[model samples]
Target: METFDLSRLTDFDFEAVCKDLFEEELGVRLELFAAGADGGVDLRHLSSAGESLVVQCKHWHRSGRAKLIEHVENTEAAKVAKLKPQRYILATSASLTKGAKDKLFEILQPYVKTPSDIYGKEEIDALLRKRDHIVRRHLRLWLTSASVLNSLLAKNVVTRSQALAEEFDGTLRTYAVNPSYDRALELLESRHVCVIAGIPGIGKTTLSQVLSAHYMAMGYELVEISEDSDEANHLWNDELNQVYYYDDFLGQTTFDEKLAKNEDSRLLSLMKRVSRSPNKRFILTTREYILAQARQRYERLDRHSFDVHTCVIDLSDYTYQARASILYNHVYNSPLPQTVKQSFAEKRVYRPIIQHRNFNPRIIAVTLAESGLLSGHHESLSDDIVANLEDPYRIWDHIVRNQLGETDVKLLKLILTFMSDIRLDDLQELWMELGEPLRELRKALGVLDGTMLRSMHQYGAVHVGFHNPSVRDFLVNYVQSDIGEVTSLISMVRRFEQLETLWLIFPAPGGGPMAETYKRRRDQLEQVASMVFHAEPVNLRNSRHGKNYVRRAWLCLEMGLDLESEVIRELALEAASDADTILNASESTDLHAFFQTLARHKTSRGEEIMFDCISWAVEWIMGDLSDWNLIEEAEDFLRSIEHYDPGIEVSEALARLDSVRDDYAESAFEDWAQTHRDPVFSGSEMKEVIDHYKAIGSTDPFDMSEYDNVLQRLDEYDAGHETPFAAPRKDSAAGLAWNEVREVQSMMQTLRESSD
Candidate 1:
């Protein structure tokens, strides 16, 4: 028999489990009430005989059987006497002995009816084993089950799997099962691919993490794709059950360099492959706006209908109960003291947080996680939570301003210079380059680890990044508010990527506080343009990609700086002269940016230079038609040239592209077949497993028994179940108390009325 740790569920989650369990056990529908000030009734049912049945659930497994009995006799007995229901059923997660049940039975003689009406942990587990539907209904129950967690921890010894297991452990504790989970699961099951799209701090990544954990539990190996779809393509194994997760597959804040390398086509191709394979699953997450931007920018993405496999997580996905549960779970799992937890429960301090218009999962998590940094007073905590929810952009303001020291703040500002995660050594070098002490880097990293940043060991090197996208979001707003900080960042730039980041945050001056700030800092803007013009172009991969130089030239033009300045004129001339080099080394988007800059700047002999570059590009494409990327790039280049200058003749180039498309398709298939004929573990996989065990101070051989046990449990659970991906229960207020439900309903109604 399998036993779950009922302690994992909050009072409300436990009550929900009991409601579902008894509804099937007793063959009657039980109406669940919200928690709080309940009059000895958590659930009630009216029998055909006109009898009232009352059931109360106490999730006091951690409080011991003695405490449970004492509370029942001293507190609940009087309430039961007052109610005088025809039948009273007691459910507690505590494992009660026969003597304890009898004692409770004697305490409330007439109302208890019989001792069998009392259910304890043992009885609940037995019922759950019999009723698989109830087990699936309450996600927390099965997700946090001892069997599942142990299986996750013991089965996979690889470094990535172990680290992910630990993360899944923490996330499962605070994760709320919303409708989006079910929808995403359905899409992944039916289509084998799910793209989770939502706004920042909307739990898109969290939902994907939970779904990844689900597949992992079902004996699927987790393959985390960090940079692009090439990682997925290289790691794809037809013989192994694998689930791939790529978070923020698109550019985080803007469509910059991520989709520039023909990633749109590669991503779609991998999706097609995953969809065709029975043992493979793919999950990708991106902000909805960024995804829309990618679709608009990339013709391939725009042409493909992602809506069929997309799961959009929005506010509507989180009902009142879901929001409340999110709050409850975060608070429950936080490392705060008991006093702070009680303060949230007292006087309904959670009401404002639950009902706030800007309620967001990330904001809620951040607020509760950093609650220790706030004043200990209950009112302060309540007010701070409400304030953070009201304006999420300021969620990290308090931490950056009040909690973090100077070195810590400086580290975050420096990190903001990059588009994504930065190598620790690279960041350290950058830190030292900016005249900061090397010793302080470690100290600042420690101080900012959980609150503001996170560091992970990948590919044998430590990589540090913001804890979430919101941290970067907060820091961008932080620096944009002050011009001095902006200038300081520009002065510290050692590569073209950092300058690109600055341009993204502080775009061409238009209308807004940022634009006004740029206006006030015109001299600093000119200084940046000059710096980029002279600096050597470097991509994120630390290579001198030609697109970086092209990007720099275009960025200077967009800044509205002096085109006649010596530095600007020199940069334009260099770009125009080296147009062939730029075309050969850059992507279609980069080529487009380069040509547009040339057209806008109109360098000396610009038209002749442009025509020469276009001819060179056409001849280069005619030289090779072996790869799909080459074909697509050629087509995009021709189309862009046509769009840029309608008078340019490109019928020959167009014919060359159209004729060899089928030849490229046949060659691409042969290439894939040759490359993937024999699938084997890569060297990185072997090294990762060895290094992971070495780091954990373990070299023991793999434990096959544990793996077999996990498989057995999975088989047993799925024996008679319809599907693991069942639809969630519709009633959001299933386990909430009556008054709390009324409060949520009232708040929701007020919101509707206000909107009307």
Candidate 2:
């Protein structure tokens, strides 16, 4: 008999768990009321005999038995008398003795009927033991069970899964189990693969963590793949039950070099293998936009139709109740003083936060964790929360500018130069090249770890990267706003990849805001072009190769730099005339870009060189249309040179590529038919799970009427507003900027005096 620490649940969570537990124990459907002014009725049921039965829940475990009796006698007895129900039942998380039940019965008279009608902590735990489904339904209860936590602690000792298990252990306390968790679990259970895709800060990674934890609790070995699918493949064990997690599998911001190294094909292969294996499970997460980009760029990935196994976590998945629970859990578990927590209970300070349009789980967590950072802002804690929610970017802005030291900021800027994680040794080398002391770099990394940056050890090397994509997004916005910052980044460039980062930031002339910023700073922009022209070219695999000159020429042209200049044109011609240099390049985008730059230049020699390169590319592509890479490269080359009247040979190659693609598509369909099957939990069992969920009613623990009213207004506002995601206006009471510092300090002093 496993007993849960019911103390882990919030007052509202406790109410919900009790509702489910009693529904099973009593075999009667109960209607739950809103949080406030329930008229001494937390739940009610009308018997077939027309008897009214009311149940009151008091989660006073911390208040002790004496306090519980006093509250029921002084406050609740009068309210119960007014209702005058035929039967009364009292439920509490507190452990009540027989004497206390008698005292309650004596207070309520005939309405109480019997002392057994009162369910205390002991009775509730016994009910939970008999009704296990109810316990499982409320994820907060089972996930925090002592057994599960102990399992997580034990698993944390394994090197392969230590980081992720530790992360899950820390986050499980505040995690609100929304519908996404169940959906992801079903997909992984059925298909053995689930790709979680969503916008940044939408709980994609968090959902993956929860799913991983679930499998871990079920006696599955956890393998976290940090870099690529090769790690998953290398660690594959058929005799063991294992769950593999690959966070941001595709790329964090852009198509990382890993994908360029043909990892997409390998990843697709691993997905196919996992789909056919019952003992293996794979979970991958990527930003929705990044996944979209990968599908468009990698033909094999697009053809595989990852959408079939993808569980996209969107804002719609979070209902009002779910949002409230998320916010409540964070606040309840935070280290805030008792007074500050009490302030949240006054006048429903949570109402505006629950209804905020930018209500993201990440934003909510950060606001609570970093609330102390806003002490200097001289606003109430509620105001600070709403302000941060209004503009999500501002959450990191103040932290970066005000709190970070000079060394920390520089280190962050250095990390920003790479699209994905940088090797610790490589980052240190770059740090030294930038004239920073090695000791300062270590200190900076230590300061930023677990806050703005994270370091992971894997594959015999330590890799450091941003803690989340939002940090990188913030740094990009930060640097683009300042011309000095942009020029400094260009001046500090040590690798061609860093230059590629700058090119992505200040893309061609039409790129939205950053392009405009670059256009305004033409001198700095020209310096970026000059740096690319003079810098040593490095290949995609991080090695020196002659083909890099072609990449450099292509990059300069894409930056809208004039390749027609005598010196620049000479370099372009020199790279283009070497047919071997163009033919050896792996990426078709690189080749297309180089030739496009040559054709745009339009010199007699450049045109002749471009024609030779296209002819050679067509021949190479025609030799092998079996692989999607070659077929895609052929299609891309033909499209790039179409304006130049690419001759009949190019048309012939495209026709052949089309035939190959059709065959591949048909073969892929056949493969899918052979592998895909109905979900393991489909039919009766799944319906039972869903029906049970619906019976539990709305999970919202707040005032139901108020929550519904606010949701209706939000819908109405969305209909008329151009930007539906805009933050709503706070109520007058919530908008007031009370002195939070004084309140916190005063509360601390009072607590100290009470202790004395």
* lDDT (Cα atoms) of all candidates against the true structure: 0.69, 0.68
Residue 126 error for model 2, in Å? 5.3
Question: Candidate 2's residue-wise lDDT over 643-741, tens digit each?
Answer: 664467667767877667556434433333233343222122222222323466632323334444433443443333221121112221111211111
By TM-score, who's the top model here?
Answer: 1
Q: Which parts of model 2 have CA positions greater than 4 angstroms off?
A: 1-8, 26-129, 144-161, 179-193, 218-220, 239-242, 255-258, 276-281, 304-307, 376-379, 438-443, 509-553, 560-601, 608-756
Candidate 2: Cα lDDT at 660: 71
Residue pairs with colliding backbones in model 1 are: 33-736, 34-736, 34-737, 34-738, 35-736, 35-737
When summed lDDT is taken over every stretch of 10 residues in candidate 1, the lowest stretch is 747-756
lDDT of 1 by residue, 302-387 (tens): 87789999999999978777886787788766776666665665445767787788889988887777766654444477688888
- Count of backbone clashes, every candidate in sequence: 6, 0
